[model samples]
Target: MITIIAAIANNHVLGKNNQLIWHLPADLKRFKLTTTGHTVIMGRKTFESLGN
Candidate 1:
């Protein structure tokens, strides 16, 4: 199964200034649970943004 996860704005916006514009604790928790024990994949920019 291939699932793409991302946080998008209500205005249909994605990011601003190369950074996420929204922060939700519940979403973060869900993200962790969804990716746990899974081989997560992300774009180079996403990894860089995470300071990896």
Candidate 2:
């Protein structure tokens, strides 16, 4: 099963300058809990945003 996770704004904005425009603690917790122990996949930009 492949599960893709992302956050899109109402204006269809995904991110800016390789970083998220907003922060939500609950969302973060959910993401962590859901993706934990999974083989996470992400785009190059998203990886860069995490300073990888």
Candidate 3:
């Protein structure tokens, strides 16, 4: 299966300033666990968020 992970802000802003608004360690852990040994999928916009 494919897993998709995304981070959003309180104002429902996705990819603000081309990046996530906040960083949560737990969220990262969950995403890692969920996608472990599995294929991941995302859009170009999502990948671009990694820059900032």
Which 10 consecutive residues of model 2 have the lowest summed lDDT? 43-52
Consecutive 10-residue window with the lowest summed lDDT within model 1: 43-52
lDDT of 3 by residue, 1-52 (tens): 4344667667788756756677788987898788778766777986575475
lDDT of 2 by residue, 1-52 (tens): 7778889999999888767879998998999899888888888876676663
lDDT of each: 0.84, 0.84, 0.71
Off by over 4 Å in 3: 1-4, 45-52
* CA shift of 46, model 1, Å: 1.7
Q: Model 2, residue 34: displacement in angstroms? A: 0.4
TM-score of 2: 0.77
* Ranking of all predicted structures according to TM-score, beginning with the best and ending with the worst: 2, 1, 3
lDDT of 1 by residue, 1-52 (tens): 8999978778989888877788788987998899999998987887787673
In model 2, which runs have C-alpha deviations exceeding 4 angstroms?
none
Better of 2 and 3 by lDDT: 2
